[model samples]
Target: MLKKSLISVLCLSLLVPAVSLAETATHAVKPLTAHQERMKTCNADAKGKKGEERKAFMKSCLKGESAAAVKKAPEAKKHEKKTAKKPKTYKKLNSQQMRMKTCNVEAKGKKGAERKAFMKSCLSNK
Candidate 1:
């Protein structure tokens, strides 16, 4: 009787795991929802795009909005304008240019000779 009960317990434990695994497998193969399908398609379509282009594509695709609509949207236009306005970077100054800039600031109100003397001292000190 004990041997029969032990064998039954073992079989039950094995069966429980097999049944759970089968359930999980069925659920794992679930069909994609409409939104998920659209996202997948859009991601595939956006493979070649990058940066703002990819961002805009994904945003419009997920929202079910058209590309033209995204382009015409005020917020999207603002984003484009903001991205367009990159900060200007000045060219690096050489030693003479750098010294001149410093001396000019320091000698802002000084007259010719005084400015010349201050500039000479500043440039020499550097």
Candidate 2:
């Protein structure tokens, strides 16, 4: 009976530490909330700033009023204007035009049958 109790106690001692360690590991790995993440970002951005500058930056950042946020409004407007402008559409060349352009490039030095054969094959491939 005494030996059994001792063995049980030993097993419990090992199990208790393992359970506590797991609990601690889980708690330690808990993800930060949105607010916490924003704060961390603001803190990093405020690294070079100090005193009133840091305080003001943190306040504006936390309030979502930083320069990036303000600049985005104008940038978004510019983007809208750019997108509002119609894109230029180009007319595709016809098969004859494409063949002429390719033949002109390929037949730069050649003449007679070679140029004719190249032009024929080039036009045929298309």
Q: Please name the candidate that would achieve the greatest TM-score relative to the true structure.
A: 1
Please give, for residues 1-126, the per-residue lDDT of candidate 1 as tens digits: 999999999999999999999999999999999988998998997787777767877888789888788555556666778788778999999999998898889988998888889888988886
Q: Which residue pairs collide in model 1, if any?
A: none
C-alpha RMSD by candidate, in order: 9.9, 13.0
- Each candidate: how many clashes? 0, 0
Clashing pairs in 2: none
Q: Model 1 off-target regions past 4 Å? A: 65-126
Alpha-carbon deviation at 61 in model 2, angstroms: 0.9
- TM-score on alpha carbons, each prediction: 0.45, 0.44
Question: How would you encode candidate 2's per-residue C-alpha lDDT over 36-85 as one tens digit per residue?
Answer: 99899889877877765567677778777867663355446557777797
* Candidate 1 displacement at residue 86 in angstroms: 18
